[model samples]
Target: MRALFRGLSPFNVTRRLYRWTMKAVRRAVEHFRRSLRLQLITTFVFCLLAALLAATLAHGMTETLYKRPYVDYTLSMQRMDWETRHLATIIRDQSETDISALQPMLDNFEQDVGLRMLLVNLDGKVLLKSAKATESQVDLYSVISRAMELRLDLNVFHPQEFVAFYPVELAGQKGYLIARGMPEANIRYESTGVNMISVPVFLVVLIYLFYRFTRRKTGYIEELADSLLVISQGKLDHRVEVRGEDELGSLARNINRMAQDLQENIERERQAEKTKNELITNVSHDLRTPLTSVLGYLRLLKDHPAGGLEQQEYTRIAYEKAEHLKRLVEDLFEYTTLSGQGVQLYRQTICMNELVEQLVEEYVPLAEEQQLSFCKALPDERLYVSVDPEKFVRVLENLFSNAIKYGKKPGSIGVTLAREADGIRLSVANRADEMAPEALNRLFERFYRVEQSRSRKTGGSGLGLAIVKSIVELHGGSIKADYRDGVLSFHIWLPVPGS
Candidate 1:
């Protein structure tokens, strides 16, 4: 029966009107509608959800604002407890039961605070009520009586809510109580703040709809323009958006694919340029040795008194320089070929202990000449690893030279061996001259050196560590530096013996 009445109610008419208005909105979007319903539906749902969220937020703010001053008034009443405490003291000292016992205190609190006050009796009945703010006054004589009747045995210590503040003697039959509310309470009750619940929601949606309405027709065009800008700036991956089967999405797809291909081709050309540079560098090194030899022989021929001891001495020096040049050229050619042509490893079962002992023996004498403390802590068991012997030897030689060159005079050059989960870690620990870790990774790049003067004195072409990196990667191992506590540790991990 209630459902039938609601069906005929004006609320139903409002919903019907809203539905009709939406239908009219849909028909109007027809001329511009290429897949119009999707745009319309997405916009409508997003807007509706946003509106509901805003309304909820506004309602919460309203409740908080409206409740604040009312709660503040309640808090202010706490200070007035001092007056109530004094009244209790007076009632206790008084012996007379005259109207002066009540009238002066009542008039003072009522007139000064503008609060209505009432005194109720012990039989849950009103004995006295102050005459102030009569408009908002509540009658409680009978109500108080009923309240106390339900809770009998109301003593001073166990006083009830309104009566708790009121000190009372039974007077053979009743107790007294008082209640109050200020004139300011009326000011709080009629606040216009709570009525503005939907005001914030209205402003937010109004701003949003104005933006949507103003920019609606040009949204796609603006997006297309932005996408074109991205493409022009070398981001060919940008797409022109045709969210629907309209012209934009198709264009974007084609443009994005074009950008991807262009990026790939650019990467390929960069790699080719790198290879060409490597070729030129290798050729230059090869040419330098023969050119040095030719220059040396020509100079020897140009010397005056050619057949003397001085000439022999000069020829010997030239030959030694030529040999050094030949060695440098050879190292250059080998390095270029190994690094440029991605050489696959020919792995064999190699004893790491044996390899280390061989390199350490060779470098120990050199370390002794430099007054360095060189020591090895090889594993007790046979330390075997599967690696290319030649490449592995190069790895050992590079580390050995680096240690001898960088290790502080009289500092320890320690080699520690331990078995890892899938590999064996061989660490070459030495104290370096205050090198940062950020600079260490680049140590494996060509022409990179810590100190130019020191490097020149050490006689390295800066290719040793770079070659070490290439060989290590080819042999399926890894190398890193662990610098801590004034110790520079170069760690090399090679896969264990046979698998």
Candidate 2:
């Protein structure tokens, strides 16, 4: 009994019921959020219910108007006609024999039918009345007089009032019996045949309209599904037709964006694959050339082992080829490492002005050897930036070496470092023959050279600029080359503090 009572505890039961109710409410809310069709259906049902309630209220209000104490017009004209005729027959039979008994009968009939009743003699003298005359009943006397003068029965009806008069004889005397009240009110009920038919017709029309509305939504959904199918079949250009600024429209927009992004990614992948193939081919050819040269020279030395001078010349040539091969291999390794996705940079806050000055000084002799003069435009202030010192040095060295190698003979190599609005800009400018726009655009691409023959003559591996660009980007910097007025300048922009 204790366990049963505990199980039936009102507090526990209420808490459990509350939890279940909340869970159900959350699920309903989630479904409402996710399903557009459900939302539309809910709205459609609510509108129908509201319309039904309004119709019911209107019918009830009409009936209530008739049922009001002062307004007695709900009785139909046909019912009024029947009641009047029945009262006329009774008065004809009883009024002539027992005029005293007719007063009681008329009063009772007045109470039953809710009408004002009066009896008057031919001269218009009131002999009997069911109730006191009020303003609405003032017209009853005229109706009785008209009937008496005409010697005929009369029925007059209006929206607010009705008056009926009948010629009658009371104990050998002639008089008029008048009935005054409101006319029948216009009211509809569900039980009537007209209302029954109209209700079904209204429901049919409502259902048809709702069906059309839902069909439009379902049709759009089907179109979206079809577009998705087309996209799944690799037609990334296919798009959904956005109809309105609703959830469906947003969904369509998202689908279109997804398709566009997918298309772009596919094109990029294809380009990357093509680049990979070119890289393999270029690497094999570059590596094989020096390796073959080294092997040929070594073979010559091996075959002519006794000729000391010739052997030394061949050994030197082979050694130079080996060194070239070693440099190419090192550059290739560095390029691959820097181009990797997870390359780590050991960053430090270093003064870029001091670093550029130091590098310029170190390369001054090499610039002189190339018949190129250094034109330094270093900033006076110590502009600081966070970068991997070693990698940043390599970037500058690559640009400087390229400028020295390809610059016009006896021309000046401009090395500039300055502070800009957004960041610090470092540039290496050289006077060279005007390069084509296509070549300038691909200057930082792997294994790309302005002149393949000149690059081979200078013993360049062609990965230098590519590696430079990768390192600069790793430090949250950008590099670009521009050619104008026979001057090719490469600019590097680094965003850092203390500038």
Candidate No. with top TM-score? 2
Query: Scored by Cα lDDT, where does model 1 land?
Result: 0.67
What C-alpha lDDT values do all the predictions have? 0.67, 0.77
* Candidate 2 accuracy as TM-score: 0.50
Candidate 1, which ten residues in sequence have the lowest lDDT sum?
155-164
Candidate 2 achieves a global lDDT of 0.77
For residues 308-376, what per-residue lDDT tens digits would candidate 2 score against the true structure? Answer: 787677676766767777677778867876775568999999999889889999999999998989999
**For candidate 1, what's the RMSD?**
20.1
Worst-scoring 10-residue span by lDDT in model 2: 149-158
Candidate 1 C-alpha lDDT tens digits along 405-430: 87888887999888888889899988
**What TM-score does each of the candidates earn?**
0.48, 0.50
